[model samples]
Target: MQDFSQARNQVLQQIQHACDLAHRTDVAKLLAVSKTHDADTVRAMYDVGQRSFGENYLQEACHKIDELKDLEIQWHFIGHVQRNKTKLIAAHFSWVHGVDRLIIAQRLSEQRGHELPPLNICIQVNIDAQDSKDGCAPEDVIAMVEKIQQLPHIQLRGLMVIPAPNHTQAFFDAQALFKKVALAYPTLQSWDTLSMGMSGDLLPAIQAGSTLVRIGTALFGARDYSQDR
Candidate 1:
């Protein structure tokens, strides 16, 4: 088995360094993106103190969740929210990081189990407005946020963004939008997270006030997608 302790610690140190450089006291938390990795790899990562994991593939993630049920891990569904999968996603994951549509949010709210605590979610924003991305346009976010906040079973946390590569300005744009929405809805007590950044752009995202960074490669090494074929 690959030793993950060093990689995890290195990433943590980089986060702290970025925070220091940005003069940010509230350091961004890391969300290890565990998509395509097996259950045992996740368990090993858990053993090294990674409590939060994000997955993109629903079936694959559910299998890992079942296999690792004994561990107290906070599973996050970080991919595009599909309507048919909301019920299972609502029941199984602790956080949904890519909610962009009101209908999707409504379904998640309605399907969440009463026994479970309010589902935590982040609205995905296409800061750069890339046609290929799966997020709401920046201008439409406030309206979506207004409707989503009224959902009874889901807590609207904040925005999740995947800006264009090397576009530091997009990170700042996302941060501005995040603050704008937060101010628009001050009553949302859980509106604190700004889930942005990944392995390549962690520093700029942190500097722009990201509260959560989804890291995969730096923590888990390069993923082999060939197995999926």
Candidate 2:
């Protein structure tokens, strides 16, 4: 096993390199994808000074949130979110990165009572237009953005896309799509965050203008699925 200090530094260096290459100094935010990692690892990361962590599973995330409530960590829901869990998700997660449907948005907006702060949301886009991907297509982003803007309880931040793997050219295409959406929607003032890329293709995504990169194995090493079994 690698030392957590070394691992954290390596990832932070990579983030700095990506940001420098993109000519975007301040926008690059590293969200440590902590799904499947245990509480010990999460605390280790926290000990090393990582404030933002990403998780895919709702229940799993909730458990971790409860366990590590003492740490000042910002949790981001990075996986396919179910409509049934809107209330819990809204109540816990500070940001939701996979919102693709208006119904889900409406549910979250309604469940987010006025007592709580507005939920920070990013409309996920399947830039590659994969049929199975859980994001809105690039062409439909404008309509979705318009609808999301009307919800006073949800703050529309920007767009997120999971491009098709192996198509390295998809990064450029995704950036073009983001530019188009930004041009179409004037209310989206914070068209600043582009939550794209992962371990294998983050460089190109950064070159294509990505602000946040969700990295898992690269930082924490391969996941041990045996725990779930």
Each prediction's RMSD over C-alphas, in Å, is: 0.9, 1.7
What TM-score would every model get versus the actual structure?
0.98, 0.93
Per-residue lDDT of candidate 1, residues 1-229 (tens digit): 6789999999999999999999998889999999999999999999999999999899999999999999999999999998999989998999999898999999999999999999999999999989889998999999998899888988999999998899999999999998898789888889999999999999999999999999999999999898662
Q: Could you tell me which 10 consecutive residues in candidate 2 have the lowest summed lDDT?
A: 185-194
lDDT of 2 at 191: 67
Question: Considering only N, C-alpha and C atoms within 3 Å, which residue pairs clash in candidate 1?
Answer: none
Q: Write the per-residue lDDT of candidate 2 for residues 1-229, one digit (tens) a residue.
A: 6687788788778877877887875746788899999878999988988889999878888999999999888999988778898989988888899999999899889988788778889889888878878888778888998888889789888877887787767778777877887888866786667898888887788888887899888879998776651
Error of 2 at 61 (Å): 0.7
Give the CA lDDT, 0 to 100, for residue 143 in model 2.
91
Which has the greatest TM-score? 1
Residue 84 shift from truth in candidate 1, angstroms: 1.3
Clash total of candidate 1: 0
